[model samples]
Target: MTQPSDVLYYSHNLNPRVAVAVARHLRAPLRYVRADPMGREREAFRPINPNTRVPILVEPSLTLWETDAIAMRLAARFDPDFWPPARREEVMLWVSWSAHHFTSAGGVLYFEHIIVPRYLDRAPDHAATAAAEADFRTFAAILDEALAGRRWLVGDAPTYADFRVASALPFAEAARLPLEPFAHIRRWHAQLEEFDAWREPFAGLD
Candidate 1:
């Protein structure tokens, strides 16, 4: 019997975008399934992920959620360049920093500016966005300082950490991220934009 390829359930959301990009970049053999967490299939999706999130990877005997874990799994199986071992500690440092300082801050602005207007269709609270923008600027400054002389986050080349740190960047323009003053970060992100996978990971996928 021909076994089915491992499946990846995904949506065109922030983290899923990165996961799909990593999977496609590595040419991982995954059958992609578009899942709607808040749709009628919400109940059906619960069996695979208690969080009812996309970017869930389901293999023949295993199921995994969380974008970082999925990205790491794919890197472990296909390409270690994304998480190079000799450079793994430095790579992980940026990834960890991003979770708490960088992406965490930008995510709030993204939610307030983009999600509120597009999905919720309500006026975003001005005070909330103001606070979020302040937080974002504080962290973005740290990132800017870190990237001043480096093209990539950890090593000479790009890694999963770059993707993790820049996860919120793709939505920057739409989310009104305060990025104009950070030349290094802008230059770095421009390089990532060179990748078709990063530019349009969900392109042509349902």
Candidate 2:
């Protein structure tokens, strides 16, 4: 089957991680446009997305920003199993929680620990790291309890919700996300790593 090649992904940093996973899972051909958020590339991309952030999905019909929305749109179009109607609400719940809560906590550590040092050539803010660690633990506990006996996030199988939530985990080790205490999260994330999309999300990109 020839998948559509209309999806154009724009990302400066690794913000398009979940979108990449969704596209790969759908067997879709995504055109990646790398743009620096703080450079001239941002100015060039302003007409595309005024937010000037990465992970924007541009299709012939619509321009989608926000990782959760992009994941849902791709799932709806290409993979029904990942976005079954009966479990739509449950899947959305996890997606929303992940974007608003999980990533909120984890993104801080990732930015301070990995992004700042790598991109800006600066040291991590210890106070920010400490606060982020505390926030991460609070949210990680909730996630651990949810995954007590489940293999995936929303249903019996992996869905867009799983990909959305686990997106930041690839940098967990490097960012020091403090996942040691959440055995279930660790186990679940380990399972996510088995997927080619999660393992090498940027495989074909420059």
Candidate 3:
């Protein structure tokens, strides 16, 4: 008999950037719960996560939020090989890099420059946009250097770092950020698109 392990996902919009990380990391089918524009302001969603964010994981008795936490928990429970080295040190590196560094600087720049202005009708000036693009380019260059002669971030095989970093790239592309400048990063992003799961959420988003 199949055990019932539920994963309810809530996001501001269907294909949220961070939520995709959880989806890819978990390799689990998501049950999408439509998020209110003020979804984070709702107490209803707070029961699952006081912060009230999307990609929240409800696994039987436990509910987890925050992208890396959900990804780490899922990888630990369901995918040991997906997380190479399988050591606490390596796992921490991936999660911390994603949450603090990649998600912090890169994610912030993507939002402030592109997603916010385009989707939410917010005002962002040209200088801010340029700075954001420059930030993304900086991170991309760092990643390109890191991946030289290596296929993945932590090791040869793809790990949580790959998914987390890859998740951010699509937004950059959507923002019209040039990829021609970084061949390795472009190739890495292409590799991630080959997965069926990666294409699933993006199917009808266009």
Q: Candidate 1 deviates by what RMSD?
A: 1.7
Cα lDDT tens digits, model 2, 84-198, are 7899998888878877888778989989988898878678999999988998899999999999978998778899888878867888988899999999999999898898977
Q: Rank the candidates by lDDT, best first.
A: 1, 2, 3
Candidate 2 TM-score versus the reference: 0.91
Candidate 3 local Cα displacement, residue 66, angstroms: 0.5
Off by over 4 Å in 1: 1-4
RMSD of 2: 2.3
Of the candidates shown, which would achieve the greatest lDDT relative to the real structure?
1
* TM-score, candidate number 3: 0.79
Model 3 spans with C-alpha error above 4 angstroms? 1-5, 12-26, 118-121, 202-206
- Backbone clashes, candidate 3: 0
lDDT of 2 at 115: 82
Candidate 3, 1-206: lDDT as tens digits: 65446665655342354465456545565555546424445777777777666667787778887766776676667777666545657756766765655545556656666667767876765676676667667766777787777777776666777777666666665555656788888787778767655545544332
**Considering TM-score, which of the candidate structures 2 and 3 is the better prediction for this target?**
2
